[model samples]
Target: MTDHTINKAVLRRLLSYALDDPKKLGYAILLLLVASLADVSGPWLIQHFIDHYIARDQYPLDMVAGLALAYVALMLTAAWFRYKQSLQFNQIAISVVQRVRKQLFERMINQPLSAFDYMPTGKLVSRITNDTESIKDFYVFVIGTVLKNVVLIAVMLVVMCLLSPRLAAVVAVLLPVVMAIMVIYQRKSADAYRTMRDLLADINASMSESIQGMSLIQLMRQEQAFSQQFSVLTRRHLASQIGVMKLNGLLLRPLIDFLSGVALLSLVALFGVSGTELIGVGVLYAFISYLGRVTEPLIELTQQLSLLQQAMVASERIFGFIDARQQAYGDDTRPLASGQLACRNVSFSYDGQQSVLDGIDVELPHRGFLALVGHTGSGKSTLASLMMGFYPLTEGELTLDGRPLASLAQSVLREGIAMVQQDPHVLSDTVRENVRLGRAVSDDDIWQALEKVGLAGQIRLYDAGLDTRLGSGEANLSAGQKQLLALARVLVARPKILILDEATANIDSGTEHQIQQALQILRQDMSIVVIAHRLSTIIEADEILVLSRGQIIERGNHPQLLTQQGHYWQMYQLQQAGEHLHKLEESAGVPEAS
Candidate 1:
């Protein structure tokens, strides 16, 4: 879009946020009008004292004293009105910002999982935090400043015209020129502001990456390289700031001062030539006072315009994210009566070009354990994500108990299905809270879930037991303990279908055995799907599917697949050999190398 069109669109949207609470906006406007009226009266009052009391010298001392007292009262009243106006404006601005920030946060969280793949976490954070903060300035300062300035200028112009039409015409002529300068500054600074914002996001992203991977960077001795990269981004950001500074210096205060000087000199020359009959001393003084008042706000208005431009750029980025079409959640709310799941002719792709899963068909009976054994790129995890409704299929029919899975509401789908990943996040909270996941579950339910996962005994050793706070990174727990805790989290929900996606891939054999025992208990009631790299864990599965390059190359129970001597057989044989070698080493008293 053209700069003007984009700015206008963003400005309109920003104003709409304020319009949400029209009563507050209306009150703010009323106070502004009152303030402007009081402001305009100040100069007129000065003119009245000069013309009627000082120059005429015809009024009594008491009358002049009364007028002076009235002026003081008028000034105090105007100050009160101005104070109320600012207070009202601030309240409205804060309300708008709170609403926008809340909506932006909600939209970010509700986006599809796929959306996060291409957008960096740090950049998304910048939009929600930094960008939103910039927009806050637009509401709190820019909106109020612009409105107040316009009112002041309009009031001054009317008073000026009444005093001298010729002088008012001069100001009217210069007004457009000053505004044109502001418009030019806005257009020129747009790209610079956008670049600054982008550079800030890059810096934030880099910092987040470096912190998250600090150990990796240290191991690889790449600290200096990352530091240099960060420095370059900051330098670019600094350059953009300098560009904005130059624009502000040139167009804002200096330009307004020059125009104000020209107006004053022009007024002098007009009165000097036209004589006292055309324009009196008091009238000239009042015009000069009005001129200073009018041009001063125009100067501030220019600066506010700069802020408005930055806010518009931020608004564009924020709105762009909020406008992204999220994954659709259908209206179907039918309860899952059974754990039976089936997929027929299912095909999918991440980028819509290459196939990730092709013509796949699978079925799991109620309370059955179905395992998916596959190579690294064999689409096992992709299938699990599809089954969980994380993405829509390119071509397929997936069903839960004969109901189309794609037609189910997200809440319904989540209620019936749960997946445990290889790497699960643990929050920095009490063990009980982590398991309950903010649900209002009873202490008995949390303890039962932990007991089912075989973690209750370990937890009981701690002084605080279930209430013990887990350290950041779950440092208090072992890898196996974290996996079991994650399982406990899912168990608390009591989903009808459970998917264990390589959950034991990183744990020890003993821990795997414990998880297997837990799974044995769970499988008696829920349909289970396990995607495993270690073939030994799934040997007892009712059915096994071997996948290669997004297609199932073999399908049968573990014993039947071994009889075929296919891909599953080869994987099982390799794992068996590795285990045998390890057992031989232990029996021979060989110390395992770290």
Candidate 2:
């Protein structure tokens, strides 16, 4: 995006945050206003002390003491007000950052599956954590401190002009030029820093990917190679940081030199051009002292401008995500009356160019079981996803009972369907709580489901039983045990339509048998759509559909397909032949005619 576009977007979103908590903004502005007035009073009080109390032996003890007291009082008041300002502005800063992060998080979750396929998890995380932090710095420092400087400069300039117009005119002339230089520097610095920010996000993405794949790295003996790749990213990150520092160094030094020159020249002219009597020594001293104070705000404004630029970069990334379209969840949802589902002339493709499921037609009557067998890439999972309405079909209609899939609201469809994927996710919580998964299932029901999956005895052996905590990813549970827990969770859900997308493929024989028993119980009350790899598992299925290369090549019962002597029969005979040979070898090994 263009720099102008980036700034405008950031400013718009930042203002929205300010508007969100107007009370904090109002309080911060009020405190700064009070503090600025106190800041402007300092030089006048010092001038009074020098001229009235210290000159010509005219010291009045009571007046001197009172002035000293007033000076201390103003100093204390300014400090108190500054503390209040920090507290109020800090709250505003935190709230705005949190609001932006929350919006970005929600948008990420609700995006279409296609969008997620393209963006990595780590990059999204950087936007929420690192990018939002930049915006927070701008709010607390730039907005809170910079505006106070504007007020202090205005009051000081007016007082200086009243004291001596010629001196004021010289300062006024140099002030705008100094400001113009700072503005140019700010624009350049902003662009450089934004590039640096994006590079840092890329580095984060690479690190996260490497950490998640650490096991594969070890198994392949790629530790050295992976470390080299990581070092490359680290160097790129260091270079970006150095670039930002270099940009600041170039701009800041020149701006400071110009301001310093202005101050020096103004002092020389005041001493040389003004008649000694016209400007008292005390007055001259005050003007010189206040000049130093005035430049402080100018310096602060320029430095804060750099931070504002960084925030602008961060905000663009944040809002770029938040402004994306949220997945459309329609208002109307009609629940399925009988759970009879169909896919009519359906076609789909992940990448639009190649179709995964082509012109397919299929149906499952209520409470019926349909087993699907296919070669590695033969559209089984795609068909299951289409049935769930997670992806819109490229060509044809998917319906539940008599209603179009589009007519059924996504929320309604999700509520009615439950799926057990090959790899199930387990959170860091107790076993019972993980299985409940935010639903309210009774303890009795949970135990009954576990017994059905042959896990009741295992639960009884643990000291905490159902209350025992499982680590994240269920690291505490064995792989087979985790799969059984997944089955039990799904069994308790009792969804009208159960989809097993290779659910039993990742478990041992014992767990697989338990899953079979659970599937048997499920068949009585719910329609089951299973994607299977081992043909023997589906031998007794109501009907089997065999697919190849995104198209169904055969469909029939076990006996009918074997009689046809096609692909299924050939595969079965090969397995039988291997088993018979194994049996003959075992028999020959025994003592002959013992």
Candidate 3:
């Protein structure tokens, strides 16, 4: 929504963040009011000195000195209050922003996996950091400065009306025109600010994407292409910012100055035509001073209005993200009895156009091992994700231990099941921490888990063993090492059920052998579902499902599937042929042409 139609609920919520610490806010308000009063007293004191002391020729040395001293004291008092007001206002604003950022981060992390599929990580980061920072300006500058200016304007108007009602009427007439300008500015700037925010998000997304794929870009020799793409986004962002700057420059201070000049000229003409008796010198001087003070606040308010508009746009985006419906699961605290998983006539579609998995029926008893073999786009990974509670089923039902999976609590599902992906992320932490994953696990358990994955000996060779620090993407480890590390992580969890989605696809034969051995130990007690592209790995599975275009074309043990001479048999024969060709070339000592 635009700033003009700022949702009351959102504004109220934003205000509530500041009001959370009412004492600090109250102290800031009090200081602001005192500072404004002190500011207003300046014109009154000047008028008093002009009318009673200077104009009346009653300048006594001691009296003049005391008046000057009192004026200086008032100025110093105003400065002190203004300084304290700034500190308190900043404190309140910063606190509110901190709370908002924390809540946004918490909400983001708790979001379902599906949300990350569409939302850009960089854009999310921008909303948490940049957008919230804009809201900080709303609290620190807009709210505090606007309130103080309003008070100052009110006091000045009251004194102006008392001094000369006619001049006050002129100001009143011009006030609406100034407000009209502010309204126009707000409307025009709102769109500009929103554009700027969107462009910034785009830039962040582009930069993050580039950084993440830097290695790929370099490998492909496409650095220049990526640079151009990033440059385009940055240029667009810069252009958006320039548009906002131009709008602010034309509308904010310049318009206020023009309006102030008009008011001053009007005052001069009124006084010129009228005599001293009608508008005294002291009154004229005070009116001129009050007019300047009035316009200063108007200028500040106009500038803050721009910031407020930006903040409103940011709040809308943030609130939109916060308002997304989280995935629904039961709050049942009961532990899962067994990991027996079953899917009955489960049909699924990502976009509701074409089905990815159709009329699928499968069951795995506790401690059983089922392997899903499929070509790419055969819905093998999708089925595994469904089993992990990553997405809601589109049709039919998936269950665990005779209970509907959807009805099970997320914690229960997590406790009972774990999945190791094809390309698992290795956290930038010590090996122990990575495996423990913040759980209260002992070093012995960590070592045992590593040993199970055949990584203990390799880890022990490092200077710090399990305590060695790993870089992001596990730069210190090979693809097989990272995969083994991920396996170690799951082993430590000791899940009742495990799904490995091509977990050994990239590992060497030796590392694959190590993983297969670990799986043998795991399958003794836990139900294992393995999604594999490699046919050799699943030869020993109790049952293997050959998925073709989302349907199971063949379901049997390796020998049974081979006897059928179906899709599974053809795939196995082709893979064996490809391996034999590679071995023949290696034995002949021939370097195959790229």
Candidate 4:
């Protein structure tokens, strides 16, 4: 969503999301209002005791005792109400935040691959974590405080008017003027906060990229370059925060001075005009107390206005995500059949300008094996993405068992297809838990998959067996070992269609042999689609598709393609020559691709 759209829809929905919790929210508001009411009566009690009991030179013991008891009872009740409200609001606010966070996370988790392509991971992280916390500030601090001050303001106004309407009139007029200033400041603050959030995300993205590329940076002796870039971003972030702080400072001091000056002026005017003893010392005392209480709301409103402005910016970000076309909703009308896949004039594009797969047509019957061989940037991975429905086809159709893949629900589509990415992601969990992925898999099934991947013996050799935790990035394992673990994860899923993107490319020959054995075991049940750079690996495929640029240049069995002397043939010959030259180099004390 655009920035304008984010502000409009996101802000509205955030308020609604907050209001959804009504029971505890209602009790909390009621308690806060009651506490304010009781506090408001304090000034009146002082006025009554002073005028009728003390200043009248008639200090009756019973009257004094009654007033004292009443004051104590009100204070006690107010204290209890305040306590209850604080607890209730705190709990309710936390729950509301968690609920909104859960919904936001679900939206992101289920988002299509296209979403990730457009939005940066760092920015998305900021929205889910940082933006949600800003909303919490609105809930836990801003909302309750705003309400309490407003009620106190209202009650104080009533009491002030009862004492003298002229003073009350001055106060009421001053409030609107204060509100006007707050509104103007709030708009400016919101804009500043929004810009600050976006800038912060950019800084975070830059830092994250730099850290991930530290090895490359070191290799190129570009550490100074990266450090200078980071320093510039750091300065930008600090400047944005300073701007917000300055805006807040400017608003607070002026509002306080203005409101305090107005109160002082109104008191002076009221004192000067009074003729009767009606507005005497006691009345003046209570008026001063109420006047002080009156400014509490104005001050609170000003402060909350600033926080709410920041929250509005956060809400805009959060709501934009929630309201974004929720990927593409799945069609749950039918279940997936077999794993047969067919593409007819299918085309997809990351950018609208260049198609990743243009006018591609192919057929893979159920339980049939196919290998996609192409030079880098020949839409191999893009084809895998399309097959998995991670990206919707921009034109034409892809079908599974004569049913349009788009028509199948996400759950069903996923149930039918599984992919082992080129660089498989291993979570920070135990080896077994990573494989199960929170699913309740039988021990027998786990062992079967492990054994099929030829990792069962390796797992048994480890001290913790299946329960062994894979350290961060699986840092404890060799690259080949990590690849075997990734294959085991895929094997555990036992999917109908398995797409391996250079699954064994990083593994040693010994590990590759194990993987080959696993594939031989898996081929009977699962249809395998492989995107391989190593032509020798896919030499036994039922059919091979050679892609150039974005279109398929050739498709045939290995022997048939070799006779054609086309792109596939050319790539094979290059591999052959490279292997022969490598063997020669190896005899002369260099490594070779054996």
Candidate 5:
């Protein structure tokens, strides 16, 4: 029952999309009605040509020629009308798909980061691209096929009645049988199509994961295992596809064709038994022709039942995603006046239990530098996420300048605070566009930002210079270069507060020195927050906080923390020793001086 209601809702939404340009759809339907009328007239014309002249002893060549010409003109007229109607239908379908894809992509991207914690990237992408395409197929194939067949059937039935009411009634009896076949097919195929769509999404998810992690898979020598896993998924998908085909074979073409034969047989038997003076040869001929035409539509309509099922399931999935949690943000749009930030008794949890951060309070003045250090799972990244407004705090106040962080508009906060992640995503767009990020910044500003990050010279060597596009395999830049590009992206914004989540971890020492120098210059104006796995990077910070199990255990400058010999001291000593060992290994890795 719920599925029925959801299907109804999906149909209504599709109807709304079709109705977006009502004038085009209305004209198309009108043309289709005309085409159906013309189509029905063909058999009547043939009946007239047969009984009026050919059956008679007199065959006037002019009249026969006239009938032939009329037949040709009628065929041409129907073809033209159908062609125009199909064009309109296609246009509307494409437009609807474009609009739906835009809305769907907007919804997908606007979701909170936390919402994606449980959702796979590929599954969401499939919803936006693949599922939306299923909707387009409904409009393009199912709607057009069903509407044309229905109009043809309706017109044929009316002509059948015009010829002989009794024979029309016989044909009408077959309507209920066609409907029964349709109902049975729908019942059997609904779950099948739903399963197919899910399996397709799973297949897409698996492919995306494999592609993204192919290097790791190869390095780990798990290629054969991954292939076997993919084979299993594909086999399941194939089984589902074959199941649908079996349904199509059983209930759609073959059974409907058999039913057509049964209808013809029934009509012929009834006509012979009731050999009355009420109907003539012409009438019988027209009835037979109409019966043939009507069954074709019944067959077509039954075939489209599977498509209708697939579209409804796709719609349900799409609406489900759109209705899920959207990132809740405040409407406050006020601009920042200071770089001051403070966290007062802040606590947070992902599942509303077992807090990840608890009772953490800290403050940073304008132009101050603060660093957070911890082992894995110590909430360092979570706190950074909060500072960047990626997720709302679970408890306590995180304020920017003097205002509550959550109350500030995302745009305002984003413009006032910038973060460059360790491995930032570069769009498959030009370098200038990447740095400018759709902002109103000039190319000069982009170049200046790049220059500050010490990547200006390296980027200039590209053939397209600022216009060079980058993504996945197209990016010729190294990992360290991409980090600099990210820093350059943020530098163009010149935010008041900068959060660096180990942004320097991937860079070599020379580039890291350049970035550190850039950060030092920016520290004269902007307050900076750094989350570091490398202890040496934060040794010169104004203050450093050492965290464990969601609470700060030590807070001080580097020298002060060393004196305390606490978690910070232990971590720094370990990193220093590791670096020393790495240098020795590097020395041993090469032959002595020569």
Candidate 6:
């Protein structure tokens, strides 16, 4: 769509948010009109006092002082209106901004996992915090400054026309000039503001990446390299900001003020030429005062144009996020009760043309243990993702029990299947909370699952037991312990199907043995599908599929695959040799007793 169309759509959305609380908005509008009317009446009171009393040489102190007191009363009323209207406008802006933030947050979480493969978390965070803040500023400026100033201008113009048509005409010249400046400023600065926001997100992204990888950067001594890269992003961001600053500096308040000066000069020159016969001295005073007051709105408006551009750009990003397509799901809400899985002629691709997994078929046994072992990019992880409905299959019939896997509701799918990755994210929360993960699992169940994973004894030694918050290094669970905690989490979840994607790849032998024992017990009640790099981890699987180049090259139980002396047999032999060599190195490195 064209930028104009997009801007209109964003404005309409913002207006809707603003209008959500119509009662308050209406009250604010009423008060703005009251404030504007009262403020504009002051000039007329002065004009009356000068023209009717002072100019006529009939100075009655009672009447003049009465007019003065009335002017004060009007000013006081206007001040009160200003306060109430500003409060109402502020409340409305805050509500709209709050709604916008919440909607943006919902949009971020509603996206499918696949959407996040290309989306950066840092940019998303920038949208939620920085961009939303820009939107808030825009709302406040538009309502409190621009809107009220506009009402004041309208009242002033109407009063000016009543007093002197020619002076009002002189002031009208500034409106078109102000409008032109606004149009040009918006046109020139939209892209600059958008680019600035993008660069800010990039800076945030770079900083987030550096923070997450700080240890890796220090270990590799790439601190200087990372610093250089970060400096480049920040410099680009700074340049973008300076460009926006220049645009605002050039096209905003100063230019508008210059135009206002020209308008005021034209008004004064017109009054000078007309003289006392055509323009009364009192009329001249009111016109000059109104011109001065009018400049405030014009300058205020031009200043707000910059914020308008920013809000338009930021809102476009926010709406784009809110409008992105949601992940497809189906109407099946009945919870999946069985672990039986069937895959027939399954095929997949990331970019449509290149197949990642092709013509795969599987019939998992009831309460079975199935293993998929392959080298990198051999589609093991892809198949595991499919098992959990993480991606749509290119061509396949994948079923959980008797129902199509894709036809199940998200709740049904999540409740029925559990996936454990190699690196499980451990929350810096209590062990009980981490294990339960907001599930309704009890403390007793948490301890039981911990015991099954061989972590119960260690946890029991802690003063607070399950309530103890996990931490780093010697203060908390190591990587393997975290992996075990994740397993315990799964046990409490009680999913019908458990998919392990190298869940034990990094742990030591003793922990691996403990996990194997846990899996053996879990296999009785849950169907387990494992993708293992270590062939030894899944030697006793009911079936093993050795995948190569997006296709299964060999399939059987470990002993049967060994007898075949095929791809699976060769992989096992290689792993055995590597293990034997590592053991020899360890023995050779042992020091003699001295």
Tell me each candidate's TM-score: 0.96, 0.92, 0.96, 0.93, 0.95, 0.94
Worst 10-residue lDDT window, candidate 4 = 1-10
For each candidate in the order shown, give its overall lDDT on alpha carbons: 0.86, 0.78, 0.87, 0.79, 0.86, 0.86
Q: Which stretches of candidate 3 lie over 4 Å from their true place?
A: 2-5, 472-475, 590-594
Clash number for each model: 0, 0, 0, 0, 0, 0
Off by over 4 Å in 2: 4-6, 472-475, 569-594
How well does candidate 5 match the true structure in TM-score terms?
0.95
Which of candidates 2 and 6 reaches a greater lDDT?
A: 6
Q: List, residue by residue over 205-308, the lDDT tens digit for candidate 4.
A: 77767777889999999999988988988888789889988887888657776777777787777787874375767778787877777776677778787667
Colliding residue pairs in candidate 3: none
Question: On residues 257-312, what C-alpha lDDT tens digit does candidate 6 reach at each position?
Answer: 78878887887788779887788988989988988898878778877877777788
Which candidate has the highest lDDT of all?
3
Model 6, residue 244: distance off in Å is 2.1
Backbone clashes in candidate 2 total 0
lDDT of 1 by residue, 327-413 (tens): 788789987878999999999999999999999999998899999988899999999999998988899899986788878888889
lDDT of 2 by residue, 1-594 (tens): 475334565587687888777777888889988987787777888877777667666778888788888988888888888888888888989988888888788888887777777777789889989998998999899987677888778888888887777666666775787678677877677667877787778778878888989899899999999889878878877887788777667766566666767776776677777765677666777677667777777777877877788788888788778888766654557666666878788889989999898888888888878878877899888788788777778999987766787777777777677777777777799889978898889999999988987778888887888888888543387666676788788888777788888877767667677677778878887888888876666776777778777788888878888888987777778767876786797788854355
TM-score, candidate 1, is: 0.96
The superposed Cα distance between candidate 5 and the true structure at residue 480, in angstroms, equals 2.0
Residue 366 displacement (Å), model 3: 0.4
lDDT of 5 by residue, 1-594 (tens): 143323676689777988878898889889899998888889999888767776675689888888888888888999999998999888888898888888888888888898888877788889988888888888877988888998898888887887778889888988898899898888888888888999998888888999999999999999999999989989999999999999999998888788788888987787688763566577778888888888788888888888788888888888787787888777889888778999999999998978999899999999999999998899988999999888888889999988998888878888999998878988889898888888899989988999999999988888888988887454577788888999998888888999998888888878878888899999987999999888777878999988898999999999999999988888888988988887897888854454
Give per-residue CA lDDT, model 3, range 1-594, as digits (tens): 744555667778789887878888898989988998888888888888888888889989988898788888889989999999999999888888988888888888777888898778789989998899988999988998898899889888998998899989988776788889888887787777788889889888888887988899999999999889888878887888899889889988888798889989999999999977788899899999999899988888888887888788899889888888787788776777777999999988887888999988998999888999989999999999999988889999999887898888988988889998988887789988888899889999999999988889988988888888888543388777888888888898888899999988888788788788888888887899999888888888989998988999889999999999989999999999999999999999999888
- Which lDDT value does model 1 have at 332? 90
